[model samples]
Target: MKIIDVICSKGRTGFFFDDQRAIKQGAVSDGAAYIGKTATAGFSAVRQAGEAISVMLLLEDGQLAYGDCAAVQYSGAGGRDPLFLADDFIPVIEQYIKPQLIGTEVANFRALAHQIESIEVDGKRLHTAIRYGVTQAALDAVAKASKRLMCEVIADEYGTEVSDREIPIFTQSGDNRYENSDKMIMKGAQVLPHALINNVKTKLGENGEKLAEYVAWLRDRILKLRLSQDYTPVLHIDVYGTIGAAFGNDNYTAMADYLESLAELAKPFRLRIEGPMDVEDREKQMLALKELTRIIDERGIGVELVADEWCNTLEDIKYFADNKAGHMVQIKTPDLGGVNNIAEAVLYCKQKGIGAYQGGTCNETDRSAQVCVQIAMATQPDQILAKPGMGVDEGYMIVYNEMQRILAIRRAKANQ
Candidate 1:
């Protein structure tokens, strides 16, 4: 029942690495380069796989389990980094956290995780990536000790029921180009397209007209594809809120106006706009967005504003839900401390009646994506994001196939 070993390893996400935005921008000139903090003069290396830290635990009984550590390239505002979460991961685990729990009972790992999260390497809270990894390894140990699925362990931890039905998968468009979206639709997939207006604004100034044209094209293509399919996928766009920057005034009103236009562009398709404004401070963010919601509601704007950015932890998720700040909150998987905290956030959002989109960075690894699908299906969130990479087909296949296996296991147990 005691954790005997903690193993942390570094690998690539099999996707080109980018700092903040989903492969939308921040890509090197080639769109496949992996550049670190210091860009080399005239030559950026093409990393075969983006950097990722995967944590696995070996128990006394020889069972092993893993957790996904999706450390985003950019951790702060405007994609600030000379830093990556992978840098601190090994030191934090081997030097700081490993010694504390090598002999601790797996049953007490939840409290162990709480202690690990509170530890500061010199005046900094443990990175969310480290929290996710350590806690996931710990939870996996507990599940193995009890001979139960990690999702079942999570439900029992939170005193909630795991929904028995299959969870739906949502895929992201491979790139910002509207035509690329049709490929996934042709393959019978639901897609998430990042408008990446923030990137367009940074590189090509005040390009709202261009972005809107792309959206119009996407709407048309999706409608044409839907004529043949039974499932009408939602048109979910994550604008890093650069649309707000497109206006001369650069305020809430300008953002709201642009959003209304986008809403009109997405006629009759269920539309949700994630991150319309990218402010880092939570209180100010909620206050400002609450005002935007008021404006949208009063004017009857069709788009829904989703909160991301600073809404990282379980507390942040709960706060947004309690205040009714955004119509929905993007429950970024890495933000919640690990599986247990993630389950709590999802169930809390469900209880509070706020729409929770179980989402994460595209920089994640495949194992983490599979781990996420299990928890999402177990908890039954409103939607789940495709992960590990931005390639719509690859990410969708990994998540979708994992969900099918989970369904089969659940059905077999029911018959038994």
Candidate 2:
């Protein structure tokens, strides 16, 4: 099938765009919004409604293949593209991208996606969100044209197998950790409660006491609220570098000691700490995480380190994976630009013996989350994130349902 037309429309993401800089600077939360001046250059407020552009490709067969262009919750931070607003980007897409996409063959997702990835305006490439959504539409179009599931298309193109079983789903608990943790437990999330411990004073605590208490509480809560005794979810917390802030960024010894304590408290539940220390620079962040990971391994600490900050692009992921920066590297989908790159990153990480958490931002769309599920199914990442919103139920539901739908179709095809 050929792309007959390219359509773009403004849409709302499942969550709001948060200024990571402001939040890190101690922005106080007032109700659902944050009360502080915007620190990020493009942010209009400390917190603002997240926006996405739906890229729809009209195919010759009258099938409409679409994907949502979305940025992460903390857009413009950790060396990501600037704030992605629909109004600012729609014109750019129409002027530069739409024409190229128009009449293009959709037979090969990798080829078409590479063409989209290669587009440039005034020396810089298209925004990650645009590339992300456009490539998603491309993949969808290819799948539709072939009359196959998206996961199957990906598997064929990438020389991988579609997971016959379900991939583990990781759910995030944004601020409402306690309430969301309960929901996660009830839903039997393979990975429970990201427990957004971004702030030191309130979430992580000055001396890391607060997070320790929260982990202890989380462990107890799961044991108390779980419907089945067999339900044992991995506890993965994203502290956003507060641990490094509290214990001193370079103090790997102290950080390892604290992580060991958290592992002890998490008792029988595997623990992974993400973004343990964001030194704000890519090289330094890698080294810091590398040293930290080394320390934990040498000491035989049970807690696993997850790299997030400064690990944005495909190149960054490979670099981090090669250096053993962390046990797992969150392949933040949107940051990597195209959906094709998400699959490649996951495959690469697995090849390198690094755990790939096929994670995107909470600030994504349902469509984006669904596409991610297909990619995870084909690539078989260690864990896939329940995304687009912080509310545990909606994100989890979207991810879970998509996985089931794919699995059902795959099984039916096999039986046939």
* TM per prediction: 0.87, 0.99
Off by over 4 Å in 2: none
lDDT of 2 by residue, 1-416 (tens): 79999999999999999999999997899999999888999998999999999999999989999999999999999999999999999999999999998999999999999999999999999999999999999999999999988998999999999998999999998989999888999889999899899988888888899999999999999899888889899999999999999999998888999999999999989999999998999999999999989889999999889999999999999999999999999999999999999999999999999999999999999999999999999999999999879999999999999999998887888799
Query: Candidate 1: worst 10 consecutive residues by lDDT?
Result: 38-47
Where is model 1 more than 4 Å wrong at Cα? 16-30, 34-49, 78-82, 85-88, 174-176, 201-207, 227-229, 248-253
Q: How well is each residue in 84-195 modelled by candidate 1, as lDDT tens digits? A: 4455567767887777767778785457567667777788776677777677777767778888776677667666666676565667754544554776677666545654
True lDDT of residue 72, candidate 2: 96
lDDT of each: 0.68, 0.94
Candidate 1 lands at a TM-score of 0.87
* Model 2 alpha-carbon miss at residue 320, Å: 0.2
